[model samples]
Target: CVGGSNGGVKIEVVDQGIGIPQDDLPRIFEEFVQLEEADQRGTGLGLPISRRLAKLLGGTLEAESLPGVGSTFCLSLPAAHPTG
Candidate 1:
């Protein structure tokens, strides 16, 4: 179940916890975005920072979820170019 085309170990975060709501999902990655039901504990900066970091590292981060089901986040890095 674990395989990669990149040289670096991809870090995946999967959670079935109260999957993000359709409308909320899009804004969750924005700065200052937070869920009041979550006690507003979310700073909303976390995702943004993570995305920025991934971009800086030449990687991509994606998220998908189903309400009341679960969520899957993939942080994929570029495959290491083999050096002779």
Candidate 2:
């Protein structure tokens, strides 16, 4: 889902896949940090890169999950203004 408010835009990516454990949620944004419970193998650089890009753009990348239920990743950015 995506929406925009007066200050910024918010985008949420939700998945019904196996959810992450609360203890490990924060590690997902770390470089090359892959969870053993993952269904497939990955290099684990995606989230880290995504977070860095978000920060560079003056935005934020975050996540929330419940084990065995699902996960949600949210990206929020400030409203952009046109410059002459």
TM-score of every candidate relative to the true structure: 0.75, 0.86
- The number of residue pairs in model 2 that clash at the backbone is 0
Top lDDT model: 2
Estimate candidate 2's alpha-carbon lDDT, on a 0 to 1 scale. Answer: 0.90
Pairs that clash in candidate 1: 6-79
TM-score, predicted candidate 2 vs. hidden true structure:
0.86
Tell me the deviation in Å of residue 43 in model 2.
1.2
What is the lDDT, from 0 to 100, of the residue 52 in candidate 1? 85
Error of 2 at 19 (Å): 0.3
Candidate 1, superposed: residue stretches over 4 Å from native: 1-3, 6-8, 80-84
Residue-level lDDT tens digits of model 1 in 1-84: 133464665778899787887777777678877766554386668998988887887787778888889998888777766699
lDDT of 2 at 26: 99
